[model samples]
Target: MKKRTHTRLASIVGLFIIASIGLYFILSNLEDNIVFFYPPSDIEKITNAKTKIRVGGLVKENSVVILSANKIRFTITDYKNTLIIEYTGILPALFREKQGIVAEGTFVNGVFEAKNLLAKHDENYMPPEVVKTLVK
Candidate 1:
């Protein structure tokens, strides 16, 4: 090959290697950080009931039970099903019945054990899948 042709081939090969490395890191980061969403029904089918997962649903009406100053219990529903969620700590003002919520934790003894609770901030918004479920 001519000198110029050789240089061009090397440049392309170097670019391909760089791109592959970048893509690998990006995918690895996503796998570690991304949390999968599982509805109430899916949680039951999961064999690793002890594994932590994210559950999104609406707070069931009249289910907010305050057990103590820092502890609270409530039922989250997907309209078709419900799961009791327990949290101990300050809850967001937006955390209330009939509103959307995403709880992150494991399920233990029939209760959705939550380590963190995130309440929807606005009345008109909901996670897209949850909203779609509610609509149908």
Candidate 2:
């Protein structure tokens, strides 16, 4: 009976250790993959400019500038604050001034270098994150 009790306890402890290690690895990978969403007002607060993140807000009116055939510069605003965004790719059809958009990219030299841009599909549709920023 004593030997059986020891074996059971050891088995439980071993399983717990394995589970802990697995959980740790899963969480670590998730942290690396997670992309945080920010508004134009909060972009300045982020210290890690190299880290990829998403910014959601309205495209500032009259801020779009065509730098080249594929390059464009625009500003995103959360009403009270704005951030310049640079993108070198085709924009979505719905992307236009004053439209709600979510831009995925990294900030460099105070500008958001967008790798991807997402625009609402319908007139009434807006990204939830942008809606939250606008509402605030």
lDDT per residue (tens digit) for residues 70-136 in model 2: 9999998989998899998999988999888998988777788999999856567788899999998
| lDDT top scorer | 2
Evaluate residue 25 in candidate 2 and report its C-alpha lDDT on the 0 to 100 scale.
Answer: 93
For each candidate in turn, the TM-score is: 0.69, 0.72
For candidate 1, the TM-score is 0.69
- Candidate 1, residues 1-136, lDDT tens digits: the string is 9999999999999999999999999999887236556667666667777777888888899999999999999988887787888898889878878888889988778887799888876656678899899899
lDDT of each: 0.83, 0.88
Q: Model 2, which residues run further than 4 Å from truth?
A: 32-36, 122-136
Best by TM-score: 2
Residue 77, candidate 1: Cα error in Å is 1.6
